[model samples]
Target: MTLTSTAPNVFEAGLPTFTYGLTATPHDILDDLRTAQSCAPIAIGPLGPEILSYSMARELLRDNRFRLPPGITLAAQGITSGPLFDKLTSSLLGLNGAPHIRLRKLVSKAFTPRATSRLQDTIREVMNGLIDHVVDAGRCDVVPDIARPYPTPIICALLGAPPEDWPLFVAWTEEIFKAFNFQPDVNFDESAIMRAWGELDDYVDGMVAERRHNLTDDLLSELIRAESDGDRLNLDELRMLAAGFLMAGTDTTRNQLAASVQVLCEHPDQWETLRDHPDLAMQAVEETMRHSPAASIVPRAATEDVEFGGYLFPEGTFILVNTFAANRDPAIYDDADRFDITREDAPAILTFGGGAHYCLGANLARRELAEALVVLTRRLSAPRLVGPAPWKSLLGMTGPTTLPIEFASERL
Candidate 1:
């Protein structure tokens, strides 16, 4: 893969400094880089070296010089020894080389798209039920009303856990992600992260033990089967993998769904197109992902000194591939700024990182988003933001934390 930069590498030439924190939304930070026009394909910042273009970001993700950012991330957070740090360093997102490949293969084998697809009936039911609550209200906050609660039931069912325990899983995963956030403030809660890890790990162990006696087609059972294949999958490995799935399978899809809804509501014409023709749900989902990805950045570190795109990345250099910027780069997409859902042959969505670390649940996430959109566009019309929809920090899985909208409920 060619690692050409759209501009001179920032590390050598006039280094454009990019800054990010709780003070600004991720989009605002990236927009500052765009507005200044001083930024290059790679911008150095507090978060990490920002990969601002498509080609460089994609290939570098697959390059051997780059690796998962657990070591660097742990150092940044001042968390060196604990269950939280260990989980950060040991999960699929943490490992590199042979172990990552082996574990990824086993997890991938169990976490199949077919398994998620089988739940189409359940997906529709969940989506419709969530919408049912707001159809009469004529206005609702999309995040808590839909996004936060939607994934829990689906993920719970997949794990063969009780659906009513969504709040517990949600709380645990929220703390779990704090360990990997690219930016954390002075108030970072180490205890919460450690506590969540411990509780979730123990709960997952119990669940796995209980499910082993009655193996079935659920994801937990499939993972158990993967372990039984004599790959020497141990208890911690199995438990952490399941916990990782709970985090990945929920938070990302939730944020993404909220982001997509926020984007659609903000763009009435696009929302109208989606509402008029529900068949465009998949296209709308793809466009939403590219335009306003839930995951603004994915982290990686330089495993060895490497010259990429005419820039030297010293070993242990932390980098954040800015999917938010790459998805909008003019060099890749025509009228890259436009929110048109009818885009013809727009590039493959880099919203999900490329290479091995590319999100395993991406396909399922897309389907879930599409199905939700179908239900939404069917039941609601002309969704417009009711008030200021506040967004979370861009340093991690970013999206509208609360998307209050007023839509004419056709079903109502």
Candidate 2:
């Protein structure tokens, strides 16, 4: 596809800077992204040296030549690299085109609906178990106790992580994701990253060894048994996949849950509506996905000149698709700034993404959020915000650092 304009594209403009309001709430970001998309899929960046912002998510999703920029590495300050580096940036979700498709197909077998159905029981149990501890506390830090670790245990059970080491997995994932916000010039050191990466690789390597010895009814064991032409994931692939699952399930779901709660707090009327109907949980989730998306952007590298709307994106441009921005386009959703959960068109949110690279864990995440809200609404007599929810300064996933909710219930 060729761009329509004769004007030089944004990619040729220079590096991206913080001009587009990176700190803006999800709604504002979406508005800007929509404007950019209508004008051109590519534009000058808002946070770095002159870079291209690819805002047409649907179009980019359809094309396969647009690769993830090498500079757009998902590496954490202290937890990525070495034998397990491939998990975040080189796994099924990381690759582009055919190789990515093949790997995803192999992994998709384990994520089938039937397989996920079996985890609902565990999901309910995990939610209740966490609530059991903090239900009567009046208030607690929701991010760490409930939102962050909630997805870990469920995924561990699905992946067959040993009970004793589940806590360790949680710690490793926290270190990896928290690195997204690390400003090395001020807060981090090389030794800290080295230590974190070493521990992560060592733990995953041990798990790989165990899965090899005793294949169980979990994803890790199943992968060990999976083969093609007598070839399977070697040690490096094994470690990376394990790390990938941990990071994906942990950060994405935690932030989604946290952001959902924040949005509900901001719109008590909408919260009451959902509390009354309960079934609106699904719609509420979609609204949260759109209004306060967990992930802020998706990066891509153009392999050929592509045109969309009315502009050109030349080959070798570093592209950033502001998913958060696309969800809030005024033309697409009426009163896009408001947090109304009951809107008839609220279900069209782009939270789980679009196209082939859509999140594989979307079903699992919805299940967790739905179940959590069900139990939470019924048990808590009155829930109110204790303080303003503070968002983390992360480049990718946007979530809260602390969320304290006051409630009368002893346990949810």
Candidate 3:
């Protein structure tokens, strides 16, 4: 594959291109990526790791040679030791090989189809209750009013966290998510991050202690008692796992829900399709995920010097898989840029990372999204955007911070 003419323009413009650890306007960047995808399956930069194409992105995720970078913990960039250091270091996202395999196995049970199936009623109740709050008003900001609050109670219930502590968990997760920004030049407040981590650690430790004495049906208790082949998660591992699950399930689901509503409102035809064929809730969620995945970029590092797509990626090279780009790769999907729920061969989207590190909470996230759409379409009619939805500027997850929508007023 050869580099396209647009490649030179990306570097010359100095606009903090997507691969350069900076957040660009996603639509514009995606257009550039689609053009580039036609020319090559991979593009190697002067100083950075290779930028993967749609096919290459899927391949590299399953490839063992490319592993998560070591020391990439939630302890901020420069801090070596802190409250979040041990927890983040022990997280499933930060580990590989035997450790990652072991932790994932223990936690995977909670997110299984059977397990999430049990939460169907609870999820429906949560969605309906949220809709009840805004139904009378006839309009509401999707982010704070609906999407932001919908998942917390469910996540808390799954984790055996106290419902009252939902607000605190939200605060801590916000601070923790900042550590995920991969931009090399971004500045983070080490002190505030450490403080949040400290408080969260103490809270999680208390929950662990309580669950150890009295196991319950919740996920946290299950993790405490979970054993396989005489192996179990240690104290620190339990705390980190609980915290990680909370953070992982919360913000990403919030963003995806908001994005789905924004997209559906913008495309009335698609919204009507969902409203008419409520059974297509899953397809609508999948379409939203394909069109606008929560996390646009995922980072990985080469464990060893290896050649991929005819380029030599040296050991320790940082690779950024532009998921937003690959999801829209024209070669992979017909009319890839358009939002169409009825695409027969929709092709799997990499919104959730693939292979050994596939998202543990994927089932739960899907259930939440499907249920939210089902309830919304059934309760509200002719939902449309009140104004332009503004997106968050973070380089990691891409979604609207405020998505205001107005719909025909009707009471269930």
Top lDDT prediction, candidate number: 1
Best by TM-score: 1
TM-score, model 1 to reference: 0.90
Q: How far is candidate 2 from the true structure (C-alpha RMSD, Å)?
A: 4.4
Q: Can you write out model 3's per-residue Cα lDDT over 143-213, one digit (the tens) per residue?
A: 98999888877888787777678789778877777666544425466667668877988998898898888
| 296-391: candidate 2 lDDT, tens digit per residue | 667666788765434466776666566666676555677776787787844355666567778878878888887777666666556778886877
- The TM-score values for the models, in the order shown, are 0.90, 0.81, 0.87
Q: Cα deviation in Å at residue 265, candidate 1? A: 0.8
The reply for model 3, stretches above 4 Å from the true place, is: 1-21, 44-52, 71-86, 182-188
| Residues 102-142, model 1: lDDT tens digits | 88888888887666767788889999999889889988999
Count clashes in each candidate, considering only residues at least 3 apart in sequence or on different chains.
0, 14, 0
| C-alpha RMSD values across all candidates | 3.6, 4.4, 4.9
lDDT of 1: 0.79
Query: Candidate 1: where are CA atoms >4 Å away?
Result: 1-10, 18-22, 35-39, 46-48, 71-74, 183-189, 227-232
Q: What is the lDDT, from 0 to 100, of the residue 310 in candidate 1? A: 80
- Model 2 TM-score relative to the real fold: 0.81
Give the clashing pairs for model 3. Answer: none
